[model samples]
Target: SSAITKSTKIVLNLESLGSLPADEAGPLARYASTIQAQRHDYNGKVLSIRTEDLKSLAIIYDMSPDELTTRLIEWGVLSPGADGSIYTDED
Candidate 1:
């Protein structure tokens, strides 16, 4: 329950944004596409996750928040954030 709550918190961090361009494929894009393809119901449409989303995904995927964040960073899914949220480097 607590874990799920924490995870939900992370999931909620996700930001619902427009889809990336077809040729703009990257690790983060791929990951986002995969999550979208899974058909997870998110307000009746696919949604994107943000840094806050990491915690929930980690709990659901049985990964540590730090570990998930590290993997995302390694895979270029998440870029270093000077502030509280991660910024996707579209370059």
Candidate 2:
């Protein structure tokens, strides 16, 4: 959760969605969708992910840290050494 960086806090108005479905087949899947939706004005763009942040993402997704990091790099969620540049797949 902490992987989201301090910047996400600035963009998103984080508050409880109120009564989310925790009994869903996959807790994280539901939570992920709801969490991603929590972002105000988000448009399928990259997030703030430093190298140290990968571990948190991996734990959230239940994947190896490196795999999630690699996928993010592939999906352009993260670019090494870039400063606050947001990218989308269509770009």
Candidate 3:
């Protein structure tokens, strides 16, 4: 049931991406770029990151981690870790 629910939610979110304006796209693009860089740094693997690590990542991307995390969670780029931290599931 949870899997189905998650899948449906993802579908809806994906649909929303199609209507985003160019101005709103900038932050999303930047977050995506950072995600890609992190993935590459881990050799195409997903790196488990703590909140502090995420803050540093935000700095690396010239954005605030709080804002970046908000966007990433909305975009499904990062998920909540077991410890309630955020991490990517790229690998």
For model 2, residues 1-91, the per-residue Cα lDDT tens digits are 3333434221111122123244422443344455566755344332322444445556876778555544544433344334433223233
lDDT (Cα, 0-100) at 37 in candidate 2: 68
lDDT of 1 by residue, 1-91 (tens): 1222232322212232233333432434455656666766444232446555566567665678776665555544455455434455443
Model 1 ranges off by over 4 Å: 1-31, 34-47, 50-53
RMSD, one per candidate, in order: 8.4, 9.3, 9.8
Model 3, range 1-91, lDDT digits (tens) per residue? 1211211221112223334674755554455446557667523223333445555656765777566566656666555455444544433
lDDT of each: 0.47, 0.40, 0.46
The C-alpha local distance difference test score for the whole of candidate 2 amounts to 0.40
How many residue pairs of model 3 clash at the backbone?
A: 0
- The most accurate candidate by lDDT is 1
Question: Comparing 1 and 2 by lDDT, which wins?
Answer: 1
Give me the displacement of residue 61 in model 3, in angstroms. Answer: 9.7
lDDT of 3: 0.46
